[model samples]
Target: MKDVIFDDFQNTVSESLIRHKSILDIITKLQESNARINRAIVKSVTNCGCIEVNAKKQNTLENTNMDIESLKTCLSTQVKGTLCDNCRDVIQNEIGNNLFYLTSLCNALDLNLYDILLKEYDKINTLGKYSFR
Candidate 1:
């Protein structure tokens, strides 16, 4: 069911992508979109003051018997507040642009966005906590 949405979005991007047809263009635009997303998030913290970054090293070893699962509870995103309506909207739009360019890049490479998502999903599910490290 959700796959239908991804397929539709990918198809739409493939059809709508007129200017940035080259893979290099698509990749650079994707990177720009990523930068916009980061900027939006930072603005939410700095300009709007809707959120605050309470960043610090995680005290994972406060308890000698702490396991991996226990560490999860102690870990923080370091974010201390929720996004206000304006920041949320700006961030969502930036993310949407990023996805559009990402889908465009996939189309240029003759790849299926949904399939890539499924493969990544399977890998994460299979690896669980060890998927990244």
Candidate 2:
């Protein structure tokens, strides 16, 4: 076994861009990545059924209230960092809920998650302080 490190994630992402790529391709790729991460989190918890059920629940609910703001609220209230393993599980559940909502929002909006992320980076690079608002 050997130790290896990749110091530049941004550079790797930038270099992966190809010509004539459609926005749907980017969104599909992101959706796939999120699915994989969601699976890994579920596996780590030793309770795949729990996360699977959460995903179903998220899909059924009409989301008039969901965002990063809601995630922060849940994390602060339900899963304070000072707690033990049982409490940390609650935090993981909250995060899973947020992830489901965010992914669903992307799907509903027909927005390419990766393209949106790239545009945000471009804004930061070009507009700097103006992007803050």
Candidate 3:
């Protein structure tokens, strides 16, 4: 059910990648797309004033008895407010562009985007809280 869309999207990306067929171009474009996403997010905060980041040091505690769920409460999304319609639309488009470049890079490397996603999902699911640490 899930992979139906991913396969379709990957196929579409493979067909759309005309000018940036080279691996070098794909990688660089992927990075550039990422940068654009960051800029779009920052712009939503600074220029559009739709969202603001209330970032600070995380409340990570050293209590050996603290459960992972409890530790999770100490973490914050570090963001305040919500994006307005225009900002939301802009951010979503930038993210979509980033995904396009990412899929393009995967196609250039002869990789399956869905397979990579499944592998990552399996790793995180198996490792649980220890996935990142």
Instruction: Name the 10 consecutive residues with the lowest summed lDDT in model 3.
Output: 57-66
For candidate 3, the TM-score is 0.91
Question: Model 1 segments beyond 4 Å from truth?
Answer: 61-65
Task: Write down the lDDT of every candidate, Cα atoms only.
Answer: 0.93, 0.48, 0.89
Model 1 lDDT tens row, 1-133: 9999999999999899998999999999999999999999999999999999999888876798977787777888899999999999999999999999999999999999999999999999999887635
| lDDT tens digits, residue span 1-133, model 2 | 1111111322333354454135576566557656766665545445533322222223313555756556444432221123346545755765654444444445446545556666877889998655535
lDDT-superior candidate, 1 or 2: 1
Inter-residue clash pairs, candidate 1: none
Which has the better lDDT: candidate 2, or candidate 3? 3
- Ranking 1 against 2 by TM-score, winner: 1
Clashing pairs in 2: none
Ranking by lDDT: 1, 3, 2
RMSD of each: 1.6, 12.3, 1.5
Residue 132, model 1: lDDT of 37
Residue 117 displacement in candidate 2 (angstroms): 3.1
Clashes, model 1 = 0
Which lDDT value does model 1 have at 69? 87
Highest lDDT against the true fold, candidate: 1
